[model samples]
Target: MCASPVKKNEPDNRKGQAGGDSGPASRSRTDRRNSQAAKPKREHVKKSARDAALSVLTGVEEAGSYSNLKLNQILREADLPRPDAALATEIVYGTIQRRNTIDYYLAKLVTKGLGKLQPWVRSLLRMSLYQLLYLERVPDHAVVSEAVNIAKRRGHQGISGMVNGVLRSAIRQRAELTLPQGMTDAERISLEHSHPEWLVRRWIKQYGAEACERICKANNEPPHVSIRANARRQHQDALLEQLRLGGFDAEPSALSPAGIVVSSGGNMALTPGFGQGDYSIQDESSMLVAEALQPEAGMTVLDCCAAPGGKTAHIAEKMDDTGTVWACDLHPHKKRLIDEQAQRLGLKSVRTLVKDARELAGEFEPASFDRILLDAPCSGFGVIRRKPDLKWGKREEDIAGIAAVQQSILEAVHGLLKPGGVLVYSTCTIERTENEDAVARFLEAHPEFVFDPIPTTGWPESAPLEQAASGMISIMPDRYGTDGFFIARIRRLA
Candidate 1:
């Protein structure tokens, strides 16, 4: 349910056409304008209920579960009511977000390296210290006692005693602890902030240390609940009025004419319009991709890599449910996901197919469709706010690995397009290697294809492309108030 952010740099095609057979020479530029935009930065409230928070975090680590999902499940299923559930949620998410900093203090108490310790034990210490430093509402004594109690329940009494001793010692001497002097400034900051060193390094390489810190800070922030008012069912303004009447703080998104960005109200699934098919919870940035496709009433379209059918449904909705939308995915389950969504949305134009998009050209004539959308598979780096694990889980090499697949898929799918057909290449990534670099490479190899300016008929003027590229839009979280995403519009010459 996370929205992916994209960064794009379309090749400048003056003369209203894409560059001659050779793609525009390297136009990579670090766009720091949005990176420097102002916003309320994320920060911890106070330290005390740290132990209670640590208990929840420790449980997640032991189980190898999602921090938010596990905590919410525990809250919903347990006898503990709302107040305790809220407290536990705060502790778990806060600790995971600020992991490096908590560990920096813990390393002072333990003689051995934190990495060398048992997984649960390490998570236990990190959780406890996080409460002591961040949650002012919870008292230190309660934190220590609850942590010890949980430790005893989950492990031997010996482990509980160890937990109590370690937490108490850290609480007493937290002011004196310091990171190793040999560590790089970014590494030290990243550790103190509880981020993986490798992620911090990548940010530092792309942006300076100060900017990287800000980016890291943003990832820890609580996300906003936004939705694309099913314009097929209702307009954005009408949906906003309904949402306001229902007692929600919602507003029309500035970037997308069809988007209503809900600041906060309640769970999306439980929202009034959800079951009625009035709207779907999609990020403002995501709404932009479907807009880029600009599906028309009678034009045939292909949603390659379409799974869960967010864009497929949107495209069908845009076409007024008239044209054929070949909804294809590599897996049968994913194809079923598209089928289910199309059914729920009352879309009849979509045709579901469980086929590898990369190999679909053999089954169709070249340039067979008027529009094609390749919402390709990518490293989910742009959505760290919702899936925090991605920050720690992604590697630089993974980008090259994914880029290869994206390139091949794009090339394979490109051949299936009719000579005059438009193709939208998109992804939820901020990395240049996978985005602009990949798109630039695609244009280099394909001489007949031309980059087209994304038509702005239904789009707002403020959403215009900043980078010098024809038919390309790159949305970044650091810049836009939504997830990062990259999108490109290309048309084959007739």
Candidate 2:
């Protein structure tokens, strides 16, 4: 049986108001005082892991905060032990990821219907059900007990009873729970994978049903932590050896020559040589963007939409910290992030600029940069593993709107590249409309830029170089074990 994280003998923290005294007129003043003192005193309940997770979930739903950001904030404030903190993070993210499916079960068990339930109550039920359905390590009774306790403290007795009854019913009926009989293929896949039906249908249209299912499943898994070794500071081999010697399960990534996959280390910044600028934490797929640009010494590069400057710093490292790499973003606040990354990596070539990519043509001279990277903003569907809330947060219509923005940015920045220069347009999204289709539209409009094949010399030999030869690469998370990403390299022809 799983041990309950709830503390023993916790206070209920509720007080009943004084009722009118009809027959107590004869009672003595001391007797009345003694009666008042006999009532149990209300004390604040000790916070539990479930309470922290519930608070984070409610914040995400009501305040529209990002799950990762909100979860980190709550965890730090709560100062929970390691095991409890892990549980809270799991419950928060897992419930958000499996919300639709949990609601499906909840609606069946909840007689008043899930729609009528208060937002917090619905959130509580979803989190509890997520544990009952997915977290096998937690016993069902303990989940029910903890949820009931929370419902009682947060709601009235009626609400607490409702939660208890619903959870107990769910536990008893777990064997009988099933998807509706006549659900269409899209509906079935959507419910089973906890994805929006429209998104699933869109993916099916683009990638077929089997591949779409694989993509959906992959999105629910935790993302691998990979870091790129700074070539200016240390060799990849040396970094890998150093990490292993420091008791980290590190190995070279199969995708990027400069990438290292760390399996055991919790925080890469705390690892050895991190402060010395040996490496920076980045996904292998993201590292590929800088590699695709193939930056060399004495080349001017523009990284449009560079914030948190991962790829921008990588571009500078690839250039041997020589020449110039202008990193630009819309938010002035994020300029420090890019500056900090450059400082950490000891790269003096990268310069930070505060400017939107769409407005770059007005600020910079035309044909000024030898290479450009447009890591455009999109719906972020590809990184669902890292940001599971995206699965529930995004709508089908968001794709077309974001695609238009991507196209506009591409057009605005195209004139900034010098003749015979390389421009790598990439997004952490697998949607074709924002990726291949966007590139297609750009090429049709601008005749001078032509597709440039992604060089595959140092890439894994198993990579489909031929398929990616047209200067376009779409990596699926399920197939590649990396974030779903799309990259297209276009070169200007004088």
Candidate 3:
């Protein structure tokens, strides 16, 4: 649920001091000032849920803030009741996620066209239309009434009338709404699933039409909150029991052995045993990265692009906290995140460093480690269900630029791996150019490295290991019900 924006009533606590006089005249003057100050506070209107949703929509649209980050900040500050917050969140994310489809409806209804309307007005209509078309629980009249009231507060009477008329007309014409005529299958899928046309076309070329549609549909759904039990502190069964005893609706993940799926937990940090390093919040797909590496008790490993150190800590945990795992990221601020995660998981083997993966060869010796995890930075198209805004935030051209960076990091880290050392290259993306193509190119250029299939013995039986013979695996969100990820394991030949 999206949280609504709140109009803060800043109470004027500045009171005039009665200077050395307890007389009625002096006290009356102070009281008058206090009364005047209180008047302004009452005039401050508490923003309605629609108003809050509008603020967040405009913030993401105009100011270019990430929707999830912006929404969380606003919700924390507004402190709206749970129901209002839920409505606000629903409107914000639902409208944004379905922007293309909503705009299609608006284009048919608005006489002036959607582009002609003011940005806030357009957002208002989109939010209203989203509620009408998608949210079955909310009544159309109530959504229309809220939009009109928000418009009246934010604009003139004519604007209010327009919003009211447009929504009412849309409600009347709901059955007639359809996508623009004469669209190709790709174009139709793009609008129907509310994804960019270019992205849809690219996916179609790679995964075919049916699979691409499923992927797009899955991206629109809410993601599960999956966590990995820290093997160093507690077993998976122990962590599951602890969470269930604490009243969390928890279940073991069928995708990863160490994973737990919590349907109704408030916050992971607030959960019992979190302070005692019982588990780490991670995706079921992401947990496989560490498992594929198969780190031993005394091995030296490098997580080249580790941030927030989820994989690095997992590696340390698998090693029974007895190995050196150098976790490095380019951003200096992220170093603390890795350190904090290591401290939370009670793993003493992880050491955080703020060095770019592309420049790792300059700081470390050649063939320095037994295992290296290169979780390269990518376009993040695979995790769109968790962060819907990513679909709009990314551009098709950005893929090539990111792929170049991934290749460079791969080349740089290739020399750092010890002969016969295992290197698992992974990304939270399903794009072939960034995953299969990149690995293919790396293998062609570096013949000394050979494909190392991810062993199935310790892996979850359900994990797709059929492709492991090629030293790579791809998990589709729709088929797996997890974040889409690509992992390729390679080994340096002695």
Question: All candidates: CA RMSD in angstroms?
Answer: 13.6, 9.8, 10.2
Task: Output the worst ten-in-a-row residue range by lDDT, candidate 2.
Answer: 11-20
- Model 3, residue 294: distance off in Å is 1.2
**Model 1, backbone clash pairs (residues 3+ apart or across chains), number:** 22
lDDT, candidates in the order shown: 0.69, 0.80, 0.80
Cα lDDT tens digits for candidate 3, 1-494: 11211112211111011111111100111222312121111113576667667777877776676776666656655677766776777778778878987887788898888887766778889988888888777777899888887765566567778889999998888777766667886998888889999999999999999999999989877677788888976789998898888888899888887899988564466555767788888889999898889899999999999997889989999999987999999988788888988987778898888998999999899999999999999989888876778999999999999999999999888899999899999999999999999999999999999899886665566778687667788999997788999999999997
What alpha-carbon RMSD in Å does predicted model 1 have with respect to the real structure?
13.6
Task: List where candidate 3 sits over 4 angstroms from the true fold.
Answer: 1-43, 180-182
Error of 1 at 141 (Å): 2.8
lDDT of 1 by residue, 356-378 (tens): 88889987887688888999899
- Count of residue pairs whose backbone atoms collide, per candidate: 22, 0, 5
Model 3 C-alpha lDDT versus the unseen true structure: 0.80
Q: Which segments of model 1 are wrong by more than 4 Å? A: 1-85, 177-185, 192-194, 208-210, 458-469
